[model samples]
Target: MANHVSSEKRARQTEVRRLRNRANMSAMKTTVKKVLEAVQKKDFSNIDALLRDAQSVIAKTRQKGSIHKNNMARRISRLNAFVNKARNAQ
Candidate 1:
């Protein structure tokens, strides 16, 4: 329905951006799940490395405007809490 040339171009760009953002969000969620799974299994040996990878994913997702920086911070906060608790349970 975008009749104007500008609008048509914008619509195309928006679709591409939407797909990219969705992929970024999905990747973030998957990485977060991987970290949580490590914690859930009470395996902290590899958690530090997993946390580092997750941090990178979070930062990139935030930088790309896919998710709010504060939301990412909150996620990291909860993830670390779980990690620490799991580690201390020993």
Candidate 2:
């Protein structure tokens, strides 16, 4: 669909970036899920570790431009709040 050379190059770059962004987002989601599961199971021993991993992944995703800074902050905040609430409930 990209007839011109520059357009073709742009299209190729877009595709590559799309794939990279998708991978980053997927990784971030998986990390978050792991943390939530640990919390849900009341596995306090590893929850902190999992939360830290999730936060790290989220920050990386934001740094990669896969997600906005505010979005990253919101996600980390919500995850932290959830974990803290569960922890305090114990």
For all predictions, the C-alpha RMSD in Å is 1.1, 0.7
lDDT of 2: 0.96
State how far residue 70 of model 1 sits from its true place (Å). Answer: 1.1
Q: What residue runs in model 1 are displaced by over 4 Å at the alpha carbon? A: none
- The 10-residue segment with the lowest total lDDT in model 1: 81-90
Residues 2-68 of candidate 2 have per-residue lDDT tens digits of: 9999999999999999999999999999999999889888899988789999999999999999999
lDDT (Cα, 0-100) at 77 in candidate 2: 99
Q: What residue pairs are clashing in model 2?
A: none
Clashes of 2: 0
Q: What's the residue-level lDDT of 78 in candidate 2? A: 99
Residue 37's C-alpha lDDT in candidate 1? 92
TM-score of 1: 0.91
lDDT of 1 by residue, 13-68 (tens): 99999999999999999998999998888777888999999989988999999999
Which runs in model 2 stand beyond 4 Å of their true positions?
none
